[model samples]
Target: MISLHWLILSPLIIGTTAKLMPIKAAKKIMVLFQTALLAAVTMIFVEVRQNGPLLENIGSWPDTIGITLRADLLATAMVFLSCFLFLAMVIFVHNKNYADHLFFFLFLGLESLIIGIFLSNDVFNIFVLIEAATLIITILIMYKQASVSVYDGMMYFLINVVAMSFFLMGLGMLYKKIGVLDFYALEAALSQVNNPASLILPYAFMITAISLKAALMPLFSWLPKAHGTPSAPSVVSAILSGLYVKTGIYVFLRLQTTFAPLIDTSELFVILGFITAVVGFMLALAQTDIKLLLAYSTVSQIGVIMIGISLNNPAAYWGGLYHLMNHAIFKSTLFLTAGMIISEYKTRKISEIHGVYSHMPAVGVATILSILGIIGAPLFNGSISKFLIATGASGSWIESGLILINLGTIIVFMKYGQLLFGHSDKKEAANSDILEKAVVLTLSMLCFLGGIFGSDLIAILFNISLTINPLSYGEKMLLFVGSILLGLLIYRSLFKKRNPLAFIRSFELGFNEICLSITLFFAFMVVYLKITL
Candidate 1:
């Protein structure tokens, strides 16, 4: 029987082998390995489904002493997503002059690390995998030479290293407190620990570290720079923005559930999410650079995911997970397509690239559909998940916040759509690459069909009978149309400036510095008030 560790090791072995082979041969071998790795992941998924989560005990050690490899539903879903994006990226960049050997090795190594991070049940193991993933991302960012690449890679490296430091510190604290580095052991210790305040220092540090890497607000200063700086191949852009960031949310979900009692901080997540959603859109509205705009949108969309997690309801959990998957699909497709646009036009300014449709009709159509999907247009993949999120917030104060963010999403995408339709009558040379067309169309089709059949697909995964009743449908459609109209009005009336918005952008750059300074002061005052009362 092939153990789950095999999934993590396959890519490492291939990458090491590539170091010893000719570049051409290495590329071929790595590609073959990725295909086989994908098959192995799928088989693990099947095993998990037929049995329960398949977990591997390392080195014949007792279950209590050994690191365990796990393949739960969430991990399997991420693996599947990684495979899809990997294959798409391979095709998308086939003609580009990458260090074929280096590119495939790094790409496969990154995929393997990603799966390892998702599948590891041991806390120490998670730390190791995270470090490996971070290193790969750094290399990926700096692989090609450009000033922006250097700048972004430096920022990413600094922030993540600091984040990892905090993560390690937290792990050490937990291990000291519990005498074990497993999730189960930590949970047991947490239940016995008095004074939740003792855990806050570590929690705050760990969460902040992950937040910086994940590009959560007020720690999102490095995001637009990092994601925008890499002259990303389309597929790389997709995976970075769509899939990589979600790993933080995954950690948030796992740890928050395990340490629920110690966390008297659910409301903090809601408030932070509100700030992120608003700040992200405001920043997005201010950007003329199309890729930067998408980067800001990533910040906003992640806020929606955080909101669902904070809601603390099963429906919210399901909705958040569903939206996470859907976001990965459509957002990645959009970014990949956007990459193709940049390659063809040699510009990142949306305003300057008028009439792309005249030459690349497939790209134009894909862009339109993807924009619609992100905006939660009816029957698109995004709508159902968006609706579920709102419904999950129904009859609560947060419902209003959800509506506000929904409107924000619409407006940002409306602005994006205008970019797509700009100069529809202008003509360009008819020189379109087949690979570009294939990737754009494939993603667009998924966006369209995913929305239409999302409920059915989600049902199958959960193994439950999901009914699409009129009440649910009507409620969703109403919110959808209302949000769209509201977004359009906001875009036309308030955000029509040619100059980009620098209001919140200014905050992100310096906000974290101020936040760190004042957090202790605030904590002191709160404690002071409690004592006096």
Candidate 2:
């Protein structure tokens, strides 16, 4: 119980303490502190795995009156992943010269906020932590003080605050109707309610805000800007794509489960997920900036994950969860590698950064592995998760949608793959940072191992027994090869022509438009729930 508290608070405590120290000493202390926190989180994960969930209520107050922190399997798994990623990121940046005390302070604070969001069972606590995390991320985005970054940071901050206000309104509604802010209590009360439709407005309000956070469709306009800001650090971009956005998915999962008795919106989510995937990859194809391409790719992958979860099949749910983990690993590797590439070439344009294999073989190799993982090639982690999702679809249109999404992914990455080849006349020195190389190698290796032992890995993480179909393997391979060929053909014949997607690439929605979109989404959700429930 106390272990959970320490995991959440220790970072905040240490970060504040380190602020008073000299820069060099503070950097060392911060790294050491992160290492210790990682070990502590690992131990807590083991305890939770062995002893079931560990729940603690602040003070001696009754369950309804006290704050609850629960270390269940899902929460522990997220915390463990967060800690591992943060540690890797810290190590990756350790030797860089931009080690500012305030930067580390905000970084650690973001870690604490994420852990708190995962552990807290109280609705209000999660809300507050999420808001704080948003502020920290905004500051981190604008840390370099680049002119355009200020606008990007302000857009991210203001838009998210508006979205969260809806969450607060929904929270108030829940308290008014149920007289409790606890997840378990709300679920119990909802189950007992005679007319669940009465909660439709609250549900709409909350889910609307969550959809924005998840960057689904129209709400996703802000994601590429924030994640691809030229001034933000690569680690910041990695954290945003790899972990922060998933907080919305986490909350979405929790809220949907809590309201399961009241409504079943899985089909609607399935349609929306498909839309998001298509829109995301299409936009990704239009990007010249490498980071923006990755940012839009995150949007597309989030849609894929959403599709898997909304399908509501056991295998698909497990696949979605596995994909969530895989995305974090491979996407982080890709972003970090992209950062190195940008640094070496002094450019973000994908077309300009050729001969990576000759210039930086390690990063180049890692980038290829990540691309394979994202493209769902056979014997990659993405393939296994995608296989599970497709199998669960049982040859329906949903499976077809998955294939189309994969095709789009392959097409965009096929363009990106250009950087891996071609010759450069100028010679460049190889990166000598062992820590950075090790991080990329480790994550890339995990991508391969995860695919090789996909079933066993699933059983270990989720305790679900899934068998691979040998017959399906041949068909999947055939489809994958066909998609690759088609993607290459499409890229060469269509994408290389006059840039027709310039409008989408340059489009920006004003704050008023974003608010209008949110309102429309909420109203749509309310009407849909009213009719369905």
Which candidate comes out best when scored by lDDT?
2
Q: How many residue pairs clash in each candidate?
A: 3, 0
Best by TM-score: 2
Instruction: Give Cα distance to truth, residue 74, candidate 1, Å.
Output: 1.6
On residues 381-441, what C-alpha lDDT tens digit does candidate 2 reach at each position? 9999988888888768999999999999998898888888898644758654888888888
**Worst 10 contiguous positions by lDDT, candidate 2:** 424-433
lDDT of 1: 0.74
Give each model a TM-score.
0.91, 0.97
Superposed by TM-score, candidate 1 places the C-alpha of residue 186 at a distance from the truth, in angstroms, of 2.2
- List candidate 2 stretches off by more than 4 Å: 430-432
Off by over 4 Å in 1: 19-28, 424-430, 464-466, 497-533
Each candidate's lDDT (Cα)?
A: 0.74, 0.88
Worst 10 residues of 1 by lDDT: 517-526
Deviation (Å) of 302 in candidate 1:
0.4
